[model samples]
Target: MSLARRHREYIQSLTAASAPAMDGGLAPAAAFDAAAGHAPSPAGTISTAAHTINLRLQHDLRRLKEIRSVANKIAVKQELIGEYDAWVAGLLEAGRTAPRGTLAPTGADEVLPTIMVWAIDTGDWRYALALAGHVLRHDVALPARYQRDAATLIVEEVAEAALRAQAANNAFPLDVLEQVEALVDGVDMHDEVRAKLLKAIGTELARGVDAADAGDARRLASAAIDRLTAAQTLHDRVGVKTQIKGLEKALAALPAPEPTDPNTTAAPPQT
Candidate 1:
């Protein structure tokens, strides 16, 4: 059989095997209360709760790995895209059963985000997009500390992936960049963190452009700088002003650009 057909069969097999095992019952309410520190419990009970949480986390992770394997294979075959979407949907459903809130089983927070990114990386845009939306909704419902941290991490991962795509000269880098930018813009964040992240993205873009055409590099770099500057100005204008002044002084110390004379036929001066 062709590789695509084989991959589809493999995905089918994986899905059949990944149905959550029906053997285990939900932990007792007392277990959750102990885990969340609402009731004082002995170390032994807490350890038991931890072990249970770990087992559930492991099952979820295994399913994610299998789904990701299928997704990766499907990404290379246009005909198998639907298969990929189905697997992504299955994985997302498994992720949903994990605990949330103070009583959430340990490690659920970290694992959910990872599963989301696996979908994102494997070209399962619909699921990835849904995961992003789900996270935003969760952020609104949950306390700021958990919600903000999760949202920020997702934004960072998406933005970093976009930068990597740009560096590799991928045709789809612009789309990824725009998606990440939209996600970042949709959220509420502290000014300082936002400025730092935007500046980091700009630096990455500038570096990528260094090996590209001069005009293109300049345009990208200028755009990056503008994003950083804008972010900084919004909440920390004084700090940004000082930083720009310092940068200007440093730039002024550099030699001026050599004038190009097209009529003279002489080579422009090298840096």
Candidate 2:
């Protein structure tokens, strides 16, 4: 069978398997809590669904651990993207069962953040950013091994991906980079990482300066300079000095705007 067809079937199977856990067909979280000598969660908090999801998370994480190399992990991520989508969808559906404010953190959840990374790895920017909104809202802790907060991870990973794509002359979506910037605005992260993001945005903007008409070239180049300058100020080693010079030169070479004819009479207003 073709890979796409197989992938669809896999997603369907995963959704079918996860429906029971989402619907509370699995063992109650209270039973596991009591057995482990942990205090029970408050009533209607959906601990049963949380516990079921956690069990699935543990299973997936174990499988990930067995992959020995980066390439292998990437391949596995492609295979599992469908599964992650189902899990995320199930969580969103299950969350509706409880009041928004009443929903408590179930401690560190590796699933959502892991899925975020995997989504990025597989070039699923839309999916990754959607999850970023939820993860940041809840202040979900990333896995211990990540050693970075969600905002930092999101910025750095997406920035690095954009840079790589640019290097290869591939068209990385500027909107995706802009969305990442807006999503993580005001969140604390290393200056270096932030600079990387700015550089990516600046470079992407600079790409179109050459092909643009005089007006557009000036505007794009100016914006590119602003971003690149901010990046340089944040981290001198961000390595955008050459790009800045090139854009500035281009902007300077653009034809000057025609002088406004202030003496010309204004056209009559249309009905």
The top-ranked prediction according to TM-score is 2
lDDT string, candidate 2, 78-190, tens digits = 88777656546644443434333223343225677888888888788998888776667657678888889889999999999999999998878999999999988999889
Candidate 1: worst 10 consecutive residues by lDDT?
A: 18-27
Compose the digit string of candidate 1's lDDT tens values, residues 125-148: 655667775555444232233445
Candidate 1: stretches off by over 4 Å: 1-55, 58-88, 91-114, 117-130, 137-149, 156-177, 234-271
Best by lDDT: 2
* Model 2: pairs clashing at backbone N, Cα or C within 3 Å: none
Where model 2 places Cα greater than 4 Å from the true spot, the runs are 1-49, 90-102, 106-108, 263-266, 269-271
| Model 1 residue pairs with clashes | none
